[model samples]
Target: MLTLLVIFIFVLALTYFVTRWAGSMQKNKMAGSNIQILETMRVTNSKYIQIIKIGSKCFAVAVCKDTMTFLCEVNEDELAYSSDSRVINTEGFKTILEKFKKDKPDN
Candidate 1:
């Protein structure tokens, strides 16, 4: 029983390290590419609308399971771009909790 548990842990750690290494390699490969996907919105399970930048031009395209169609060229000036991955929450948890309590009806 102890040997089985040890083998399980070893396999789990190996899998985690392998996944992290593969992801880093893939990210490095995609760095400094001319074509980049700016944003993607899913329309259905297999369909998506994407904004992509190639060279200095940006375009909107529709992507399906096996086909991609060009929708139109996009103006970069009109787009709202953010480099930050984290969302800024202006309200604190205590303030939100107090507001919720105030809004609750007394029975």
Candidate 2:
């Protein structure tokens, strides 16, 4: 029983170290690449709240210059889920935005 427990603990610690090391390597590799923030805002206006990168690949995600949100990369490589990957027949984003436009609340 004691032997099994020690082996389990060692395996857990090795897994933790490997995960952390792999994450750091990916970040540094991508950093060296020309992953630039293109001039586009998907959700917010005038703030560049959304960014685009055109390098070895392109991705769009919620990143801004204000630094309110930390730098986290959401790789748009594959489908997030099986359901979300299916085709959609709804109107385009512009139409939806215009339809939901609201006036500023009188503060």
Q: Model 1, 19-83: lDDT tens per residue?
A: 99998899789986999888899999999999998999999999999999999999978888676
Q: lDDT tens digits, residues 1-107, model 2?
A: 99999999999999999999998899788767676654444556534454445565545455555544534444656424356434454686788676667543545
Candidate of highest lDDT: 1
For each candidate in turn, the TM-score is: 0.70, 0.37
Report every candidate's CA lDDT.
Answer: 0.91, 0.62
lDDT of 2: 0.62
TM-score for predicted model 2 compared with the true structure: 0.37
For candidate 1, report its TM-score: 0.70
How large is the C-alpha RMSD of every model relative to the true structure? 7.5, 19.7
Task: Give the poorly placed runs of model 2, Cα more than 4 Å off.
Answer: 37-107
Off by over 4 Å in 1: 82-107
Question: Model 1 Cα RMSD, Å?
Answer: 7.5
